[model samples]
Target: MLISFGEHAKVVRLEILSKIGEGLQDRESGDRNTD
Candidate 1:
């Protein structure tokens, strides 16, 4: 049970990181478009 919980946490962390990365990329592209 503990192992499963740990794995779940890792997955959630990875998802959050990916989402943040995508957001940064979107902002960067938006800035380029404005210029």
Candidate 2:
């Protein structure tokens, strides 16, 4: 099995987006706790 460069890039982008989403969710929850 093999992956192309474009396909690899797509996977990398998705991983990055998911990480960013998690960070945002964590920040929002932290703010709620502070209040």
Candidate 3:
């Protein structure tokens, strides 16, 4: 159970990081983030 929770948290963190990176990239490229 503890391992499953850790895995879930890792996945969520990865998703969040990807989103932030994408937002930054869009901003740098002067594209519409639209969020």
Candidate 4:
């Protein structure tokens, strides 16, 4: 299985975005717990 450079870049970008999103969600939930 071979992916072009552009396709690999896109996959990497999506993985990073998802990780950031998960971190944000965790922070938001923690804030709610303190209130």
- Highest TM-score: give the candidate number: 2
Tens-place lDDT per residue, model 4, 1-35, is 99999999999999999999999999999999999
Candidate 3 lDDT tens digits, 1-35: 35688899999999999999999997977755453
Better of 1 and 2 by lDDT: 2
TM-score-superior candidate, 2 or 4: 2
Taking all chains together, the TM-score of candidate 3 against the true structure is 0.74
Best-fitting candidate, scored by lDDT = 4
lDDT of each: 0.95, 0.99, 0.86, 1.00
Give candidate 3's error at residue 30 in angstroms.
Answer: 0.6
- Full-model lDDT, candidate 4: 1.00
Stretches of candidate 2 off by over 4 Å are none
Task: Give the TM-scores of the predictions, in the order they appear.
Answer: 0.84, 0.90, 0.74, 0.85
Candidate rank order under lDDT: 4, 2, 1, 3
Q: Which pairs of residues have clashing backbones in candidate 4? A: none
